[model samples]
Target: MNRRRRQWALKKNLLRAAVLSFAVSCASNAAFADDEHRGRDDDHSGRHPKVEHVLLVSFDGLHEQDVARCIASNACPNIALLAKAGTTYTNAHTPGLSDSFPGLAALVTGGTPKTAGLFYDVSYDRTLYAPSDTSCTGLQGWNVVFDETTGIDAMNGGALTHLDGGGGFNPQAIPHAKIDGVCKPVYPHDYLKTNTVFEVIKQKLPGARTAWADKHAWGYDWLNGPSGRGVDDLMRTEINSTDPATGTDYTDVYSHTEKFDDLHVQAIINQIDGKDSKGDATVGVPTLLGTNFQTLSVAQKAPVAKGGGYLDASFTPGPQVSAAIGYLDTSLGRMVAELKQRGLYRSTAIIVTSKHGQSPADHTKLVKNGDTLSKLLESNNYFDASGNFGQANTKSGSLNDGTGLTGTGFIQTDDVGLVWLRDQKQLAAAVKTLKDNLSCNAPGICADGPGAYILYGAPLRARFGNPAEGRTPDIIVQPNPGVIYTTSTKKDAEHGGNAPDDNHLGLVVFVPGAPGAGERVRDRVETTQVAPTILQMLGLAPKLLKAVVSEGTQPLPGCEERRF
Candidate 1:
């Protein structure tokens, strides 16, 4: 009887061991399944399931009307394809000046000039010293010109001639600022007042990478923001530099500009392939990567007689413009194909938009005033005795010349006028002078009925910012829609104005596998919203960006709804 009891006890112990082993095996399998599901559905810590990358492409001069017309005519099949799964914002616009510096800043920083502290590429800063004044003791106000002349070989007088802009910004051309009571050179990255999307992402998502490619190797350094290392990979292909094959500035011809744009296109492809911009190093794919195509912008700026601009007021593209648009469409198609091939199509979000749009789509309305605003101001003794309109002092004497302020102020003009006066007391007199000489025939601004107007005083302060703070323009002149304040004979249209064509942009947010048959959010949106939207898509808080918090910038519509 004792032996039987022992055998029964042994059998019960064996049965308990088997049951325990089965439960342990089942639990292990369940844990593995959970991990697999998490990998697929909770890639970004379960915050967003679809988007792991955001590719932001800026077609420099693309307009909202251009998108509509292209789609209707089937000229932009690739853009149309993206539109099929995207939310097209018809009334999107740049919040401030349409110049490239502020335009790009608005897209990445989520703020206008007021918060970003960037007015133009070549603008005036009252608190900073001139590039020549390394001691920072010569003058408090300097014409901060971060252009081609700021390139690395700028002092050698051959920066623009090289395809790489002499390997980036020249240290000599950078402006000086007084920090900690010491004079310090202010690089492009240090000039901006706000943090960028790249910086925000780096702080929030430690492992994510960011990259960008633009026209100027030097001037575009502002995109790096105050952190100075915001972009992990900033390509150095300069668009304004002379292409060796053509022996002319990239923008001098549309075809040449296309070749220049191809470099950036390839760079984007390399980034997508989990390689560095040069396609050499094996860095993982960046979370945020993009580039700007200058071909369309060059096409729009080309002289109408050379088959550029719209053929009519109905937004019809001329032969050259049409060709440029088609080239951009093809390039975009290549990127889309690359994304799909890598199985990243369902995980990537592409944002297509423009920094600013070319003005006077109506070719007949174009008025090339030929630096009339600056000349008018100069003739009125607004500049020094040497007639220097705060031109940058560079070895090449490229854009502007000598700089010594004995007279009233400096003037920067494109399609509009941005006047910065040394003496604030002359504001009223300057406004009176500008208003007194508004004529199309005279060597001054043209009057296109009620469209032309001047902004200054409290109104200008409200619209832009307080001029007393030094960076804001003392006076702003929004000329007629078709007026371009340039003397260059190469182009019929210009940007950097508040005209409908200049501010109105083509904004499309495309997410693969998104619900709905592509909605059109006609509600007006600003390019500033793009920065916040990018962060939100990454499962990161938009408020991580300082500008978003300060400006109260919201994400683009349909983003929160995951509509596209």
Candidate 2:
């Protein structure tokens, strides 16, 4: 055949494939919906077929590209195994800000920062009073710093000595909010504006046991939702706490982070064995249980010289990262093996995704601004005379001491700059200052530089939310892809940004004995959908989740369609 004829034939074949795929997807969805209706009619119960347990796992900093590369190279055997039996959403992404708070909130709450009221882990809340001022008196814009330091140690000068997050959040570190004219301290759970999947599951399935494990004992408390009792067993393994063996934090080394993650892994195994997270109590296996692995996140942040981070923009893993992925795969295999041993494999649904992906996967584009954005804002009179730029109440008696809220102006920067101006009237001035100084020659943020741009005024509000509401940042500066606004030389990349490398996530929904093995869904989906999907799997109403109702979240496409 001639060249043009051959090209025409190829195009025709491609169109045929596309049409076939669409038809199959529609048929699958229709079949599952029919099955669901029948199940409800026959059983008189809301539960879906096949799945009795939902195991949600988050591999922080695991990008879609990482999963694709790993699976292609057979580096991540366990994930590959899940993908082979499940549908992998290759174009999945986080809903809003890539910060851990908002990212994780999106997954569990089925909402974005706009509805969840979560922007970053340590963010500014203009409606909240300082932690020290519980009476709802003077100076409202409180820098809400809910991290590892928010634990009980803060009451005694801040010491992260224990693994259980110093026995949970310190009352002293909690900000106060006036509700119904009564001033009350707001715990991490109260910070959320919407309910979580855990809360919905608990409400719908009264006997269902919910649990979760994460890095922070205090900051992650928000996962419990507004009720604070959503999760029946919330693990308190603090990753930032000092490890006696290494004399440093678990995040200081990739291998050390593996050791830290292993604790959660063991907790999961214990849960599978019909025990609590500690393996000491027989609390029964939780219906919804999972943990976030930080080893990959640590490896991505570590310097290249330390055998961490990616080798190039293609996301080929370096030594530390490769090992971290291997470890995660092995850990996942262990969970699958446990499920099989317990004869729960066919009845369980597994979800593998990430809170956020590390930015500047291409190391050659790294730009360390050394906190220059804060300095510029401070020098330009964006902050008070005391250099307090919305950040205050230093329980540790130092500025930006990394323990308590101790900065000026609510400025949090990683790969992007989230600025909540102390004075909203100065939004224009701040934007101009950033625009005027868009030069790489200066040791500050470059607005017009490569992959750099400013978001403020109506555009910023339209995308994020109305900044006037207090939680949203007045101005946002997404700098160059690799331009991290930090001075720390310990890491090469960071997350918490809108960059491609930061938001693009890996998402896989695996159910044993489910049809459509090795199917890949190229359709774009949000991580927020995971919440409602989980409810659907458990035969609960997704609308039971407040965010699902408000945000109009839908179940993942292949999830309900491919009935096990």
Candidate 3:
């Protein structure tokens, strides 16, 4: 075929696919709306034919390429087994912003950051107040309450209640927010603005049990939202918890974090056995049980001797990386075995994905630079005298004593950087300043700079939402591929960016007795489809989630969209 003809054909095919997808979504939505009006008489929608339980697991920092390579090499046999019995979306992706807060929100809330309102864990909100601001009393807009080094435990609300120390929320532990006109400590679950699939299940299918375990006490809280804890049982074992176990101190979620993840695995097994981890009958067999694994991500960054030493971005799994994959597969294998033993395997739908993929999959591309962005802005007097930026509190003390940024902006630097300018009018000048220093030293700009791709003006608003949207950052700085904004020795890799490895994630859906078992679909999809898919599998309306309707989320293409 001639070049013009081929191009025309491709465009025609693309348009056809888009139209088909849209048609399916509209039809599904209409069917769901009708069912909602008809009440729960036909509760068993039969959309998910054989599926009764849904298991969602995330391997943080897993890339689609890595999954194919690992499974091909037989390093991830359990995952390979799942792929053989399920459909694998080779081109699965996370929504543009790759932060875990927003990434997981897409899966559980069925929306992207635009609808979920979660840019990053430490993003800015224009309408929210700094803790020290007298206008809102003690309410802080930014979610800076996740630091574990600040003498707060990562789980049980930093105390005895599994969320708190038993007395109630620790005033000094959590970020304070004024809810319903009362200023109180902000629990981790309060950060999300949307409803989770768990909440939907609890509301729609009252007797259905749901449980989830995650690296941080608040990791799974992104889904629970403001409904106050949605999961029937939530296990919070801090990945960075130093609380010793098995004669080892938990470092991060990568190195010695397997023990912590194992606890969650055991909990899953117990939950499948129709009980909680403690052998208590508190949480009956959960209809939805899930947890995220971090071992592989850790292995990808560790030194050669420790099991991860990829030569480059080729995604060649080193011993550590390969071992991490094997370990994760084994962990998953255990859960599958338990389900089978209990005769629940055939009735379960398994979803495996990642919150974000690690960047520089080739460790050779890892670059460590100081916070040059902050240094440049601070040196230019862009910050307050104390250089507090807008931070009202740190591990040291509360900045609310009024010593922090009174008129200065805030800077969150990582693989991605968010700059919230206190003076919105200075945005033009700031953008110019950042653009000028994109390479190296330029005039007043310092030396040894990786520069940045500034996201502001029309382009920024076009990609992300409007800056005036409260939580949206005034200026976004996505550093070059190898340039991480911090010099922290803690990790050799980081996510949360537009990098190929950061957004392209592994996705597999396994439903036993389904005709598509062992089939691989090359369709490019997003994790946001996961929530609605799970809801459909559970025989519930996907639009029951507000974000699903608002964002127009669609179920996975191959699934049957039956009307309940």
Clashes of each: 2, 5, 11
Candidates in order have lDDT scores of 0.80, 0.80, 0.68
Look at candidate 1 and give me any clashing residue pairs.
151-170, 152-170
Model 2, span 1-564: residue lDDT tens: 699999999999887765433111211111123333443222233332356788999999999999999999999888887887678899999975798988999899889888898988878877887667667875677788788867776455556788887785776668888999999999899999999999888888868899899998887888889998999999988898888887888988888899999998999999999999999999888899999999999999999877879898899999988999999999999997787677666567889999999988888988786777777887888865455453344546643233344224578888888998868888889888888877655745755655578888888776678988888898888887788888788999999988889999999887644467678889999999898888877767678888888778887877643321
Cα lDDT tens digits, model 3, 68-107, are 9988888887888788767788888888778887888888
Candidate 2 segments exceeding 4 Å error: 1-49, 390-408, 560-564
Candidate 1 least-lDDT 10 residues:
22-31
Off by over 4 Å in 3: 1-49, 130-143, 147-169, 176-185, 218-220, 245-249, 252-255, 303-309, 390-408, 440-452, 560-564
What value does the lDDT take at residue 265 in candidate 2? 93
Query: Candidate 3 versus the native: TM-score?
Result: 0.82
After aligning candidate 3 to the native by TM-score, how far in Å is the CA of 535 from where it should be? 0.6
Report model 2's TM-score to 2 decimal places: 0.88
lDDT measured at residue 67 in model 3 versus the true structure, 0 to 100: 84
Clashing pairs in 2: 47-539, 388-408, 389-408, 389-409, 390-409
Q: Pick the candidate with the highest lDDT.
A: 2
